[model samples]
Target: MPLSTRQSVIIALIVASAYFMENLDATVIATALPHMAATFGVTPVGLSIGMTAYLLAIAVFIPISGWVADRFGQRSVFGGAIVVFTGASVLCGLSNGLVEFTVARILQGVGGAMMVPVGRLAVLRSTEKHHLMRSIAYITWPGLAAPVVGPALGGFISTYFSWRWIFLLNVPIGLLGLALTATFIPNYRASTHRPFDVSGFVLSGVALICLMYGMELVGQLHSDWRITVAALTCGAGAAALAIRHLGRAAHPLIDLSPWRIPTFRVTLDGGSLYVVSVSVSPFLLPLLFQLGFGLNSFAAGLLVLAYAAGNLGMKSVTTPILKRFGYRNVMIVNGLLTAATIAMCSLISPSTPRVLITLVLLIGGLCRSMQFTGINTLAFADVPPARMSSASTFFSMVQQMTIGLGIAFGAIALHAAVLVHGNHAQLSLADFRVAFLLVAVLVLISVLYFIGIEPDAGREVSGHTRTASR
Candidate 1:
């Protein structure tokens, strides 16, 4: 049975809620690490083990989320994910020691790995082809709120109240989302039972965990180089094995054959690059304002709110813009604009007017939001119906890798600049300039990928036709 209009909207919102909670939890701890570490009687740096644990849990489990959802059922698995996430959040808040907190976070990461992709599976199954673009836009645009809100909210809560409240606050949101999900999200699953690919799962999990963890280690100033090298080499070996197995396995965990599709390939190769750069901005911007500019956390967060507003404000215009200009053009133009805005950040200083700084960030947010929605919609526009689940899972998994790399890349840039300066002094504005410039150049380079995409490439989803071309 086709889902009704009202039901479809509700379903999209439900997925968005899960995505929000997941993104929020991922970022909120950044601002509160000092306070969190104080309670555990450890240095802030020592508590990075908890962060790494959470990320590792996510890497190990996400590759299987789609298969698990298929095997069990979407609604059941997604609902269970919410329960685990919510319960784990409570545990995180109540944890009294570093070990306890790390364990809780690992549990939370398991929930998170399923939370986004499974919810997405439901949406992709329920929404119609013609309505796909609009439905996706509805779900995605709202979740952008999490990254911006997480930093500000974490800073506010830690400053005014308790850091634990950050975790506790999700309790109510998760419970409400769970109830609504049970009421609305349809129970969709594949009819035939596919044999589980145990080898593929293990190989992929090891590959991702080692690769991401290695990337994180490389970014740390004190990390051992030999360990980083070993982790990266092992990750590469494991990934090669996984790819070989996937090619020969009957019913592999995910089908990389989707890469043959031009849209999917560009999205995977090019879109991943853009995500890495954009992801760095959230981590970089707050540090720029708070550390480099010597602003209080509250003030820095207030400034970041401009970027959030720009992100949200672009939602109303995104669909129409894609319809008007088409994916290739919009992605190329808006992408460059986004890169320019990021480069513009290099020009900001304590002497720069607050209004000017906000304006630059706002424009960057708006452009990046359009680029994100466009790439996502186009990636699926050409995908066959049968492969939707696999495509969604694969894309989401790749996104997780790049998002993790983004923050680490930003950290490495900052630390590298500090090293070059040969100073024990605190991070200066110049270090941030170096970081922003590096990432922005990467973003600029990705624009060339869109040039390879045909002008009419995503026409079905974009509703862009020759007769309507401007």
Candidate 2:
């Protein structure tokens, strides 16, 4: 039976709730690391191992999520993942030592890896083609808001309350999600069963593990040069092998058929780059306000709220705008406008008016939210029903990888700028200028990919038609 519009929107919101919990958990921990380290009797840097354990678990497990969901059924797998994640949160809050905390985090990562992709798969399965724009918009907001909101929320919680509350808070949310999942989500499974591809899983796992770890290393200022190079080199080599094996395998772990569609290909190629570029702003903006403008952390955080507001502000109009402009036009025009705003950040200084800075960030945030919705929605617009699982899985993998790399890219750009200016002692406004410019150029480069798309691409989902050029 086809789902009603109301039913599809409800399911999308349910998945969005899950996505919010996952994204918030990933970032909220960052601010509480010092407090967590104090409880564990270790330095802040030492406690980073707990995060590493979590990320590695995610890297190793995500490639196989589709297969697991197919074998066990989406509801069973997704609901079980929530149970595991919620249970792990409780264990994390009660941990007495670093080892126990690390173990709990790994469990959380496993649950997160399965929860995200499978939950999204469930949404895709339930939603009709024409309603995809609204469905994707519902799910995209959490990702835009979480990065801006997490640190401030974590700091507030840690200041007045216990750092443990961060994890414990998820208990109520997870339970709610579980109940909703059980009630609304269907037990969807593939019609035909395919054997698990163990070899493909191992190869892809190694590739993602190395790739993610390498990006992590590069983001750290004091990481060893040789290890970073080796990790990246090994990741590239493993990725090549994994691609080769997946191409020839009888039942590949992740189906690569979606890449054949132009709309899907644009998301994987251009959309990934766009994500990487936009992600740099959040990483760089706080530094720019604090380091360049001499503002306190709280003040800088307040400024970022404007950006978040812009993100949320766009949600109401995203569907109508896409319906009005279509994907290709929206991406090309909005993408350039977004890049221009990013570059405009480079021009900001102490003398720049506060209102002006906020306005720029607000505009940038609005453009970013629109671009993300368009790219993500267009990805599956042309994907067939049979290939939906593979397409969603593949999209999730690329999204994770690009988000991780975005932070690393920002760090590298800032470091390079510092070196050029010969300011090893302290960073200056000049450094941020160069970094913002580089990131803007990256966003602009992604525009070319959008240009390759047909003007009427994704018209079915957007409900927009291009008139003949008379």
Which residue segments of model 2 deviate by more than 4 Å? 468-470
- After superposing candidate 1, which stretches have Cα over 4 Å from the reference? 419-425
Q: What pairs collide in candidate 1?
A: none
The residue-by-residue lDDT of candidate 1 on 290-336, one tens digit each, is 89898988799999988888888888888788888888888999889
Please report, in order, the local distance difference test score of every candidate based on alpha carbons.
Answer: 0.87, 0.89
All candidates' TM-scores? 0.96, 0.98
Estimate candidate 1's alpha-carbon lDDT, on a 0 to 1 scale.
Answer: 0.87
**Candidate 2 C-alpha error for residue 462, in Å:** 0.3
Q: Give residue 372's lDDT in candidate 2 (0 to 100).
A: 92
Q: Please give, for residues 133-174, the per-residue lDDT of candidate 2 as tens digits.
A: 889889999999888888778877887899999999989999
Q: Which candidate wins on TM-score?
A: 2
Which one is best on lDDT? 2
In model 1, state the lDDT of residue 15. 87
